[model samples]
Target: MASLNVGGLGGYLREQRRTAQLSLRQLADAAGVSNPYLSQIERGLRKPSAEILQQIAKALRISAETLYVQAGILDERDRGEVETRGVILADPTLDERQKQVLLQIYESFRKGNGYGADDGPAGEGGTSSAGTADAS
Candidate 1:
């Protein structure tokens, strides 16, 4: 079955923040939240309500709807397929290569004819799908 990680949204946000090189205080200021609270959320020690999530999303310049879906606050349209993949790939335990692998599989699965069953096999049955593979 397709799965999602409810905890991933926080980590993803944290990564984005870091990529933007914004300090917690700066992000919090931009998002209009307390630094401590934003820190807690980044560390996965706290969860934000939808309204707060929207604010954070705005600060991150991403869609709140996308954040909700990643946070597991919203169900994925493809029977949780997208959410599930995001959760797994978002895991902090994964290295960059692993994350890339997961993303490849997810993209292939998403575009495949059958998601799970009649669905076509993952790109290489265990390999990352670089370009050139039929998305179908």
Candidate 2:
């Protein structure tokens, strides 16, 4: 795994906040963070936990996947999740609405399980999402 780009993440967050026209305090309030702590994150002085990232992503109305990639917690070029989405969209038997619903369900399961952009080889102790589903 690559070391995180904390400074880059901070810059991106700041940019997103500006684009949303939210003051730092407003964003911190929306994300359930302290103003000074959010400012520190903006200043690249603290490495935020994944939960904080999720909160910020939600508050900013941005996809957490993009933020994860920016934070180096997820690989940008990981194509397995992309491929899955593409396959769902490419299925001719399913209408676009059905495909969208399926994709949303798939994403919810992924989020619940803490899956990310990558689908590296599963460890013996860790089941792939498919395996987990099958076992259930």
The best candidate by lDDT is: 2
Error of 2 at 51 (Å): 0.9
Candidates' TM-scores?
A: 0.52, 0.62
TM-score of model number 2: 0.62
Q: For residues 1-136, what per-residue lDDT tens digits would candidate 2 score against the true structure?
A: 5578899999999999999999999999999999999999889998988789989999999877778788888667454586578689999999989998898788657644645334543453333564344211
The residue pairs found clashing in candidate 1 are: 3-84, 4-84, 114-119
**Residue-wise C-alpha lDDT for candidate 1, range 46-108, written one tens digit per residue:** 878889998988898876768777777665554356556667877999998988777776666
- Off-target runs (Cα >4 Å) in candidate 1 are 1-6, 78-136
